[model samples]
Target: MDLHQLTIHQARDLLRKKEISSVELTKAVLARIESVENRVKAVVTLSAERALEDAGKADKALASGENGYLRGIPCLIKDNMCTRGLRTTCSSKMLENFIPPYNATVVEKLEARGMVLLGKTNMDEFAMGSSTENSAFFPTHNPWDIERVPGGSSGGSAAAVAADEAIYTLGSDTGGSIRQPAGFCNVVGLKPTYGRVSRFGLVAFASSLDQIGPLTKDVRDCALVLNAIAGYDPRDSTSVDCPVPDYTQALVPDLKGLRLGVPKEYFVEGMQTEIRDSIHAAIKKLEELGAEIDWDVSLPSTRFALSVYYIIAPSEASANLARYDGVKYGFSYENASSIWDALEKTRQFGFGPEVKRRIMLGTYALSAGYYDAYYLKAQKVRTLIRREFDEAFKKYDALITPTSPTVPFKIGEKADDPMQMYLSDVCTLPVNIAGIPGLSVPAGLPGGLPAGMQILGKHFSEETLLRIGYAYEQATEWHRQKPPLN
Candidate 1:
């Protein structure tokens, strides 16, 4: 059997039936990683020994009749997530050698479900940039075209899955980190509601907007992974105390009368012509598959979403990153004569340019005179954005939009211009601000690069988002296309 091509669900079923051992599947993925990782640069650290050990244990447990949805499945986690004894770098030199004493909540949950940890994938340092170029270590290349970047800061996770280096991978989305990269890589990525997945161990970029989610080859695989990771945690104050739904079971819902709202604002003048056409084609396909498409509705607040996200995310980032000063943990410079000088030099050397830029921007935004004008006003705008989504959800089952404005760009194409890079996330930032669930499923490749259609649902309505994506994916062949790596 070609273990490398099996979805998490398929691999799990095979494991349960004794058709294949978890060790075999894990080894197959490790071998693939060894073959393509040099050119793709997807993985920062490979946990081959640990993954085989875990898979062996999982195989033994299954032999003894223990089972779960993700049992014995091999997967990767974004470097930002803490894994006990494993280097969780967050793609920064600051924590290059830092190993957490405990596993993150999501890590513990996935491990409990018997999922094998393959390794930690690379990402933007502190999850600060749109392209993986900001990673202190290295930039992840798109599997479809090595010259292009797999959209980031979760680029490595998306690229790894797209390149078939792993079964699936986890990513954190602050502003389109998960969905955008998934689009660029031609995979299924979902950003659950802000508090749907606990953020306890996720390295904070923006407290209110950050969310941990999955990047998989298929919608069903995404559901299986989501089932394992979604839940409330008391350790994270922002985690909602809402009930977790059976996401896998939700994938089979009937779409006959489902109302899918397509906001006119998403298909504006700035969007690439091909992306607009591709999204419309996907909508037509969904309509043919029994979903009702609602046309051209206004989402005025969405226009302001990008600006608001920049202000809020950076502002929170400045505060959250304050602890990294040469004090307690992470990288520190001891050569400086004074402690303050040491702290400054450590941060200066540790953080990348994009991170430092945001830190400065955020610090200024939240400073004494600018707080009410910038941060407070942005918060008010956020409420307006949320209200717009709430009003739309009241009339529709979900909102459909282009996951990104254009297909994946060449590496270093937008890396030099930060504002241009920020605009890449225009369509996705609104959902983050609204604190709603959004799913990005491969629509098709236009101009040879992958494009995805974004589906947004009401707060904590991940079940609805997954159901819609599943139904759409079932009728499309785009997700089956593999990037040429041979």
Candidate 2:
């Protein structure tokens, strides 16, 4: 068997038995990346030297009878995340050459656990788009179909795992960045509650909505990565103080008598027939597993989640991205007559079209004349969305929906139509607005493309989410299918 294709749990077991050293496992993943990354463009930067160095240390520690669960496992970090001395371009011309001086809190925690850093993966510029097409550099091609996208802004990370370039990867989800890409790439992805993972070194998009999580081949690996990264950090005031649970220990597949809520608003008109049919089939499978499906529960605010997310996310983005002016940092214009002109010219030339549009819209919303009308109204709507999820969770163990309204579209299908592109995230935006935990697991491929089934739980209910996903994965062979990379 290819060692790179093994799950994190399996790799760790082999490492503990001295069947494989961390260095050997890291080399297997690196070799896979060398063979496939050029065609897929899944990795933007490769860190072979550092990865082997880290793996050597992990091997030494193990030989001395010291071990950690993730010690020596190869993993990729999304380019949006800052890694000291590594080029962390959130796939934008603005930060194309910028390197951070410190590691993100999550990076620090992962390193402390001995996970090997494979490389950085591509993403949408400032993580603003639903498709990887918005990346300023290059769009990551889906491993399953080279003609289609891998989804975004976490597309590269998903493609990397699906292509067997890495055992797992970390991704940030503001709206559906993690779940949508996972769905498209046929992997497991989790978006933890807001503040569940510290955001100290993440380049900001929407402060309130943005969250960091994991994408992997299965639920067990997802839980392993989450256990290392989720915790409070004093660097971020918004970080929550909840105790981290033993997520990996809760992978029970039996959902006997568990209440599963099916929201009515999610299955409305405009949804693609293939995706809708796939979700209905998944619901029936859950019912067969002893899960009771409830049909009347609804999230009335679901209809407004996309609108509210657009306004609030961009509004916060405008303020956060203000630091990128020519004077302070990143891709400044050379030899301008005046400082003001330099700042203006730098921003105009550095940011991509989609990024510039969001920055302008956010600036207008927060401007003196429209703050109360646009920004405040969005917040009020956000509260309604959160309350709806809270009420539904009171009676249901989890909620089910299609991760995206359709399978991955052609690379440029909706590139010119911003509204049509935004609609792709309609089923996913509500989870971010509500700050609850959500998981996207591969349902099956319909029409020759992959579709994902989203499982949502109440705040801090990641344990339940994994248990449900693992059960479904055990029952179906969908996730076992590989992309035809050769």
Candidate 3:
């Protein structure tokens, strides 16, 4: 068997039947990483030793007839999530050496289920940019085409799954970090409703907008991961105290009577012809699968989402990242004459250009003179955007749109163009702003590159979104297509 291509569910069944031990699976994954990590640049801190140790434990437990869906499965984690005793660099020099004393709640949940942690995947510096090129260390290349960028800041996690470096991986999405990359890489990525999963151990990019989610090979694995991690945590003040339903139950292959809406604003002018056609075909497929589509849904504020996200996300980021000065942990400046000088010097040297750019933009937005004109107004507009989604959901079970406006672009294509970079997440940012769930599933490879179709649902409505997504996935073969990495 080509162990590298097995999904989480496939591996779980094999482990349960003792067809393959976790140790052998872990080794297979590690071997694959060793073979491809150089070209993909998907991993940041590899924990081969730790992974083997955990796999050994899983094997012993499985032999004793104890097994769960994720038990003995090898998985990769995005670097931004703190992993106890392991380096959790957010792909930046700022936290390059920072080791947390405890694991994030999601990590703890997965570990409890006996899931093996492979290693931390690369990401944009502090999860700020749309392309993985913003990493202070190195940019992660798309597994599909090494010359193109893997969409980011969760690019490494998505690329890892797309390249079969790991079965599935966890990624944090703030302003489409997870979905955008998943689209570019041709995998399944889910950004659960805000507060649906704990953010306790996740490094904050934009606190209000940031969310942790799963990027997987298939929708079933996506739901399996969600089952383990979606819940409220007292550690996260923003966590909603709600029950997490069994997401696997939403995997029904039939979508009869389901209502889907396509906002007129999402299919904007100048959208790439290939992407536009692919999404339209996906909608037609859903309709053929018994879904009713509404074409007149409108979100007038859609055009302003990019502008609003830049303002609100950076403003929160400016506040949250202030803790990274040269005081407690992380890198510190040695030749500083005073405390203030040390703080200034550390950030100036440690933060990447994208990080610095956001901080400056945020600081200026929240500054007293411009607070009302920029930050406050943006918040008001955010409320309107959220309200529009709320109203739309009342009439539609889910909303459909293209995950990205275009397929993956060549590396450095948008690196020097910040506006173009920000626009990459235009279709995805509103879901975050509305605090709703969104899933990116492969639609087709138009122009010989993957394009993603996004499904948006009401708050805590991941099940509905998954149900619709699974039906579409069953009827299509896009998810089965793999990048020609080998």
Best by TM-score: 3
Report every candidate's CA lDDT. 0.91, 0.92, 0.94
lDDT of 2 at 175: 97
Query: For residues 90-111, what per-residue lDDT tens digits would candidate 2 score against the true structure?
Result: 9999999988999999999998
After superposing all C-alphas onto the true structure, candidate 1 shows an RMSD in angstroms of: 1.0
Expressed as tens digits, the lDDT of each residue in 1-486 for candidate 3 is: 689889999999888888999999999999999999999999999999999999999999999988799988899999999899999999999998999999999999999999899999999999998889988889999999999999999999999999999999999999999999999999999999999999999988898999999999999999999999999999999999998899998899988989999998888786798999999999999999999999789999999899899999999999999999878999898999998999999999999899999999999999989999999999999999999999998999999999999999999999998998998899999999989999999999986699999999999999999998899999999999988887
lDDT of 1: 0.91
Off by over 4 Å in 3: none
Report the lDDT tens digits of candidate 1 across residue range 208-233: 89999999999999988888888889
TM-score of 1: 0.99
Top-down lDDT ranking:
3, 2, 1
Task: Give me the runs in candidate 1 sitting further than 4 Å from their true place.
Answer: none
Residue range with the least summed lDDT across 10 consecutive positions in model 1: 245-254
Q: Report how far residue 41 has shifted in candidate 3, in Å.
A: 0.5
